[model samples]
Target chain A: MNDSRYVSTAQVAEVLGVGVTTVKRWVDEGILPAHRTAGGHRKLLLADVLRLARQSNFPNQNLGPLFAAGHALVPAHVQDLEQALFVALERGDGDLVRSLIQGAYRRGVPVDDLADGVIAPAMQRIGHDWETGKIDVFHEHRGSQLCVAALHELIGLVSSSAAGRRPLALGGAPEKDPYVLTSLLAELVLRQDGWQVVNLGPNTPLASLRKAVNELKPRLLWLTVSYLEDADTFLTEYRQLYQESDRLGVPVAVGGRALTDSLRARMPYTTYGDGMAHLSAFARTLSPGKRRPPRGRPTKQSNG
Target chain B: MNDSRYVSTAQVAEVLGVGVTTVKRWVDEGILPAHRTAGGHRKLLLADVLRLARQSNFPNQNLGPLFAAGHALVPAHVQDLEQALFVALERGDGDLVRSLIQGAYRRGVPVDDLADGVIAPAMQRIGHDWETGKIDVFHEHRGSQLCVAALHELIGLVSSSAAGRRPLALGGAPEKDPYVLTSLLAELVLRQDGWQVVNLGPNTPLASLRKAVNELKPRLLWLTVSYLEDADTFLTEYRQLYQESDRLGVPVAVGGRALTDSLRARMPYTTYGDGMAHLSAFARTLSPGKRRPPRGRPTKQSNG
Candidate 1:
């Protein structure tokens, strides 16, 4: 029980092979085990810091910098990206928001994958923080604006890619859903899955959606409603739309957090309960020409 | 588009073969599709009601009695049970609480599976509701107590089941986690998977967990942490525990939302991301004597 032992933040940084700023960030995020000296400088426990260094893939150095960078080299970084995006949005810093999305995309992060991995989680956290009064409504709105802009930019990048299978997939928030994050994510996912997506954006009118379907002739129509209270209104309109669309032989997929109970039962279209799972299933469906291997085939694949 | 009709609650209920009370409850819970007339009575579209009736797995006549009893034969009735348990907990109605647990158990739902299927989902809904201010703090606490009591009762019943295999399993809240619902679900899942679980309950000190491990000699320990802030504390303690326990030849299995970060790092030890998947995996691990037939070899038993 050598509790008397201590190490400098620099030593911790050395152990993790990261810079002092990174170590400080780790301390700020509470990733590093630390104590403060009488003069208020951070002190690290030698044994604990060493253990963390070993556990973290910090390139065989002190763990301080890696901790500060908020678990860089892992999906955990996405969490930080999410926070940064939200903060940038709150401040209405369009430049910062654009930079973040561009940086992630340049790093080979798929726009759709980024939506699922980074944007969606960030939006969820922002909403939670706002609801908990950890953040104000202004900040939430700011974050949303930034999100919309980022989506717009990302959608442009998507348009540059070679279109794969479907001509178009339409999705957006039903009239009552204020939060369009799920819809945005769905649009990004479908676009990446090689469908030309006509994103109607949030709170699109039902009549407009029907008109869009008639005019755009999307191969699939996707609808997202995040409020259960809106389900009846949605279904009432949906039944009419489904009747008309069914004649055109287009399949409709509906999903959102608000889907439960009679709403789930009453909707004749396909429903997805979870966002990412639904997107993955949709992607699988769109990946044409890939067949399931016959039974008993030995296969070797690298670990992810 | 015949805008000429609106269905009364009775007519809608008649179509579903359910009592108006049940339809109202479903509406209140945002489970059913309905609207209010000028006088405020509920109205349902005929097509929507029929779709719900079909989805509920009830004959038109049966719906009336089921609705009268405030029940529906939906496959996810187990989810409804969870909601009811949480609602009873929220209301602090001890009688309703006790009856739901008893009914579920006596109805041949495995006590543990009932916990997983009913209790966990209910708790999630409760948490979400509480966060959204749809339910108050007192209700949340009441719901938590009911779930804890239900788990206790189920554990007792499971202990008496001679037909069940009991693998040694440990359960406890990860550091800083106030919510015991996850740990409770883990205990139920383990028990349902035929593992005898030692539920250490909420917020056990790390040292106490170590001592219990030494005394109980459990083959596997389940740790759950939900809050992001607690991750650092849990990880530090868990690393030490893992090191010490590994020497004693015991493996610790961890899950819950907290394990999300740990998954990316490829940490040592097994981690379950999904409760059902985790339970099935644990069951498979325990039942090593069972094996699937070679691929493409048709056996007398159908794997399906």
Candidate 2:
């Protein structure tokens, strides 16, 4: 192992402006990946440290020592983010992928663009590679896991922005859709614009969604169809959900690769989005200004 | 709706050591629950604000202004935490529930205690209420949703502490379990002790676990069976998984409400945990000191 290629725990702590204990704790928790020396000292690759610093959005001047130490930080460009993300996912370097997305967002890349341009394409390429036998099934599963982790972190970061009295947006992947990324992205995108979201997550049956709509009474309902187990069952149940949403006067935003031209033609969604940009745009139309009050149904039992 | 009982966003910002914009953002994102005045100003109840402060672990001295406003801040006792959590969940107060859990954890409550003492009993009460017709199904669902959200937030907070070269612990809820909280809690408890966890989430089939074992080769495995749809299938599949894990020398820790005493006799596990405490104790036994390298299988394709 090349010791010079890695930085010590204290060096990373100083760079990130945190105590050494915090850095050590972060490493122990698997937040910051590190290697143990023969003498049991923790060391981190300079590249990983740089990624962490960038993701934390620390000032450039604070990272002067890192550069002075002879390690180069290859700044990822917006155009190359997708490629970078793809490589990170392929390597199963979850922290790197997280930092790339979060660092870009903190640097002012819009959520919709990140979703539509970066993650969507990178994940699509991963899928394509799997289909062509370029990657193993485990590689593909690992990619999804990395993506989900990154998205959850982003959601936590962005969630503080969508405050009081916002219109609620409830959504999930359809039954057998199985993909968690698209639905999670939808939550993040809507949340970026300050919509309260109840993400039912993947494999949500349409009947449960209808029940959710009746119970939660969200202003908007979004569905991401990644893979359908049975097309006929989906079409029938989805149509029922559409009619239910229509009766409740709620707008539905539908998207995902599984919603091909043929499928779109048969479904009755208020908006069909090709990407997060479209979802962002469509959701904006039903923003807080048009917030609808819950129906005049009898209120459920109160805790009081 | 009483203005006198409410505090402005600025007041919350001051107490929490953040900017007014950040407070507004938290309210917008539903991180902080707030009420909108007829004049369009955001005002939060004093109790809710206190919950937020406590959850954030802000010092009491900084909360002098809030105290002077003539609103009492009820200091939740350790014994009362479960009751408070139950009330918050019953009211569908996700933010409060999150604040309660996060605040307790920050104040030195162990992860295992929080899982076993606070969350489990509260959720169990909610389940009992639903069964006895004391609460509607939505109330039960809402409780689960709130619990999941709180657990995810706590996971994100604790993740920074578990930094380097930790043993990977992989597991999830079995197919038809459909409960996310137990599996997530398992992840948090393990992560607290510096374990790298890959929680496959609810509804994970046994075959998927077998595949994951072959690929990830985790040092340990855990399954939280909150609900079982079919006994015979789970038994057969679970037996196969137990044999596989045993063959690979991975310890399996099993728990949850659905794992009845009868089911235990039928399944084979290295350890059977009744609560998070048992899981936590069992996991510590297999800590990094007993670290095992990946098996002698040929290394798969590397991103490098």
lDDT of 1 by residue, A153-201 (tens): 4554454334245466766666655565677677666655556655655
Which CAPRI quality tier does the interface of model 2 achieve?
Answer: incorrect
Off by over 4 Å in 1: A1-77, A83-95, A110-112, A161-166, A287-304, B1-304
Q: Indicate which candidate wins on TM-score.
A: 2
Best by lDDT: 2
lDDT of 2 by residue, A1-304 (tens): 3344677787676556555887888889887889998899998888888776555433332353343233322234545777888998887766567667766665446789989989988898998997897876556666776687678767776775334688898888887666778988898898777788887777777887887788788899998989988888899999999999999998999988888898789889999989989998998888845533368853221111
Q: Candidate 1 residues B1-304, lDDT tens each?
A: 1211235666655555556675677765544444542234564433334334432344423323222233222233677777677667665554476568756654445544565577677778777887897855434544664555555444433331222233677657654455656776676556544455556555555655776677667778766666545555656767777776787877667666666754437455655555645654664475334222122212232223
Q: Per-residue alpha-carbon lDDT of model 2 for B1-304, expressed as tens digits?
A: 1213457888876766566776787777756555442234665655445544433444331555654423222235656988988999897766677778877765556688889989988989998997997876556766776687678667755552222356998888888776667888898888666577777777777877877887789999998999999999999999999899999999999998888898898888999989999998898889854322112223231223
Q: Mark the regions of model 2 whose C-alpha exceeds 4 Å error after superposition.
A: A1-15, A18-79, A124-142, A161-164, A205-208, A214-217, A230-237, A288-304, B1-79, B124-145, B160-164, B205-208, B214-217, B228-240, B288-304
